[model samples]
Target: MRRSGATLDFDVDTTSGHPLYIPNGDLLTANKWHHVVFTWDGNVTGTNAKWYVNGVNKTLANIAGSGSRTSDSGYSPYIGALCSGCYFNGQIDEVRIYNRALSAEEIKRLYLLGN
Candidate 1:
């Protein structure tokens, strides 16, 4: 996804059910909050996909596929808030992505980073 205005870029894979977040436009504003989460239900192979932010989950599912791509070719990218041209003007802290659905314990961990 591309950021036109103040927003974020993300993509979800239907085959693996994994969500990927990408920062296309520019750095976030200072002293603000920005985060992202990704969950997968199938298999994740290779490292084609990665969390741009620090402290995010690296590998997700255990199932292996034929190819070594992080995302499938047929899935459409998901964009949030920001569009192309426009950019975010705030501080971004503690971006998180999970392979399986996050439990209450995991959510709390993320919250702690922001606070």
Candidate 2:
């Protein structure tokens, strides 16, 4: 997301069926250069999942889940601005994506640089 008069930008996404759910109350705000990248492979065979913000590993309770099963290997890749029809209102600079999930350290580095 972008803000008026800001130089940096932010972009984030996840793998297929491994959707990123940014709740209405949780909005990313940046005053300068910043970027966020998220990816998931939809590996649901095991009951394990993870979430990161600005490249930092967040606790499992911090991530939103369906409580049943979440996988990222589906055919259709889920990408958008907000969860459940909520549109982002800030100016977004750039967004990038990778087919595979990023390591915890990688996410932190990206987030630090963006911020």
Q: What is the alpha-carbon lDDT for the whole of candidate 1?
A: 0.43
Best by TM-score: 2
Worst 10 residues of 1 by lDDT: 60-69
Angstrom error of the Cα, residue 67, model 1: value is 25
lDDT of 2 at 108: 78
Compared with the true structure, what per-residue lDDT tens digits does model 1 show for residues 49-114? Answer: 332322344342322334333544664433343335444444434444445666545755765666
State the displacement of the C-alpha of residue 88, model 2, in Å, after optimal TM-score superposition. Answer: 1.3
Residues 5-91, candidate 2: write the lDDT tens digits: 322122233332332333223325555333445444543321234455556544432233333343425534323333445444454
TM-score for every candidate vs. truth? 0.31, 0.46
Give the distance in Å from residue 67's predicted Cα in candidate 2 to where it truly belongs: 13
Task: Itemize residue pairs with steric clashes in candidate 2.
Answer: 2-91, 8-33, 15-40, 34-114, 42-71, 42-72, 42-73, 55-107, 55-108
Task: Give the CA lDDT, 0 to 100, for residue 41 in model 1.
Answer: 39
